[model samples]
Target: MTHIQIGCNLSYTVTQTTSFLFNIAAARTLQQTIGEETLQLNPAIHFETFTLGTEGIQVYRIVAEPCELQLQYHAQVELYPDRYDTAEIIETDFQHLPYEVLPYLNPSRYCESDRLAHFATRLFGNIPHGYSRVTEICDWINANLDYQAGSSGESTSACDVLIQRVGVCRDYAHLAIALCRALCIPARYISGYALGLQPPDFHGFFEAYLGSRWYLFDATRMAPVEGFVRIGIGRDAADASFATIIGTAALTTMSVWAQ
Candidate 1:
C-alpha cells in the first residue's frame, strides 16, 4: 500500500454572493482509505459536504457573500489499487458492457468522440486490440503533443487539442478519451492528486474500460499511475471540474501538493 499526503489552499475574491461547489476532497472508495483530513474556510462560513453519483465523489458547497474567501483542504490517503496483467487484459464487447460503462462510450462536452471516429480508426485501426492498443494511443499522444502549461483554455475540446497539438494534462486526457471512445472503447475522465508531478498540483488522467474493469492511463506521462489518488470520475472534464462558481468570483491563488 502507498501512503500519500495531499492538500491544497485556494484564495478567491468574491465580488457578489457566490455559490462555490468544490470537488477537491478525496473520493471514498474501497480501494483507498482516508486516514486524517480537514476542510477549513476562513471566516468560518457555512458549507455542506455531500456525495455525488455512484463514484462516491465528495463535494463541498459554500455560499459566500462579498469577501476574501480562503479555503484549505488536507488529507492522508492509503491507496490499494487493483493490479492486473496487461497482456491478459482483453477488451470487453459492447453488447456485454455493463449499463454504468455504456455512457463513457458516447461523446461528451470536452470529448467529441462522434466527430473523431474516422480519424481515430484511421490512426489506430491497424493496431492490435486490448491493453496494448490503448497504450499505443497514449504513447502517440505523449510523443506528438507539446505539454505547454497554458496552451489551451476551458473552452478547448479534444478536437482543438488535436489540431493545435499543444495542451496541458487535462487536454492530453481529453484527447485520449475521445480517441478511445471513437474506437468503440469505453473511456472516462478522472481528476485526482498525483505524486511526482512537476510543479505539483491536481492532475487529470483517464481510465479505459478493458476486460471486466477499468484500468487507469495517463497520456500526459507526467506522473506515476500507481501514485494517483482519484477524486472524481466522469465522461469528461466538465463533470469533474475542481471548482464551479455560480456567481462572480476570481481565483487569486492556488497551491496544491501531493507526496
Candidate 2:
C-alpha cells in the first residue's frame, strides 16, 4: 500500500453572502482509505457534509457572510489499487456491461463521444483492443496536445482540445475519455491529488472500464497511477470541480500539496 499526505488551503474574499460547495476531501473507496483528516474554516462556521452516490465523493457546503474566508483541508490516505496485466485485461462486450457502467459510455458535457466518433475510429481504429489500446490513446494525446496553462477554459470540450491541440491536464483527460467512449469503451473523469506533479496541484486523470473493473489512466503522464488519491469522479470536470461557489466571492490565493 502507498501512504500519502494531502492537503489544500484556499483563501477567498467574500463580498456578499456566498455558498461554497467543496469537493476537496480524499475519497474513501475500496482501494483507498482515509486516515486522520480535518477540514477547518477560519472563524469556524457551520457546514454540512454530504456524500454523493456510491463513489464516496464527499462534499462540504458552507455559507459565509462578507469576510475574508480561509478554508483548509488535510488528510492521510492509503492506496492499494488493483493491478492487471496489459494482455489479460480485455474489453467487456456492451451487452455484458454493468447497469451503472452504461452511463459512462454515452457522451457527456465535456467528453462528447458522439462528435468525435469518426475521428477516434479513424486514428485508433486499427490498434489492437483492450488495455494496450487505452494506453496508446493516452500516449497519443500526450504527444499531440501541448500542455499550456491558460489554453483552455471551463467551456472547453474534448472536440475543442482536439482542434486546438493545446490544453492542461483536464483537457488531456477529456479527450482521452471521449476517444475511449467513441471506441466503445466506458471511460470516466477523475479528480485527485497526485504525487510527483511538477506544480503540485489537484490532478486530472481518467478511468476506462475493462475486464470487470475500472483502470486509471493519466494522459498527461505527470504522475504514476498508484500515487493518485481520488477526490471525485464524474462524467466530466463539470461534475468534479474542487470548489463550486454560488455567490459573490473572489479567490485570492490557493495552495495544494501531496506527498
Candidate 3:
C-alpha cells in the first residue's frame, strides 16, 4: 500500500449566474481507501455532496451569483494495485466480454476507435497479441509525441493528438486507448492523482481489459501505476472533467499537489 496526499485549489470569478459541478474528490475503491478529506469554499458557501453510481466519484455542486468563488480540496488515501503478468496475459474474446464492458469498445468523443481501426491494423497488426501489443502501442505514443504543455485544448481528441504528436498526459492516454480499441482490445480512460508525478496535478491514464480483469497502463509513464489513485472512469475526458461550468466564469488561479 502507498500513502498519498492530493488536492487542488482553484479560484474563479463568476461574472454572471452560473452553476459549477466538480469531481475532484479522491475516489474510494476496494484498492483505494480514504483516511481523511476536506472540501471548502471561501465564503463558507453551501454545496450539495453526492456520489455517482458505484464509482465513488464524490460530486460537489454549487451555484453562485456574481462572486469570487474559492474552492479547496484535500484528501489522504492509500492505494493498492494488484499485480498481473503483462506479457502472459491474453485478450478476452468479443463473445465472452461482459455486457457492461461492451461500451468501451465503441468510439467516444476523444477516442475515435472506429476511424483508427484501419490504421491500428496497419501499424500494430503484425505484432503479437495481448499485453505485449498493448505495451508496444503505449511505447509508440511516448516515442512519437512530445509531452508539451499548452499544446492541446479542451476539444483535443486522439486524432488531433495523433496528427500533432504533442500533448499532455490525457492526450497520450487518449491516443493509446484509441489504438487499443481499434485493435479490438477493451480499454477505458481513468482520472486520478499520481504520486511522484512531476508538476503534480490531476493525471489521466488508461486501462486495458486483459484475460479476466482490467490492467493499468500509462503511455506517458509519468508515474508508477501502483501509486495512482483512481478518481473517475469513463469513455473519455467528457465523462471525467474535474469541473464543468455553465455560463461565464473566468478561472483566476489554480494549484494542485500530490505526494
lDDT of each: 0.95, 0.94, 0.90
Candidate 1, 112-134: lDDT as tens digits = 99999999999998898899999
Query: Candidate 2: how many backbone clashes?
Result: 0
Q: Model 3, 37: alpha-carbon shift in Å?
A: 0.7
| Model 3 lDDT per residue over 139-164, tens place | 99999999988999999999999999
lDDT for model 3 comes to 0.90
List clashing residue pairs in candidate 3: none
Select the stronger candidate by lDDT from 2 and 3. Answer: 2
For model 2, residues 82-197, the per-residue Cα lDDT tens digits are 77678988889999999999999999999999999999999999998899999999999999999999899989999999999999999999999999999999999999999989
The candidate 2 region of ten consecutive residues with least summed lDDT is: 81-90
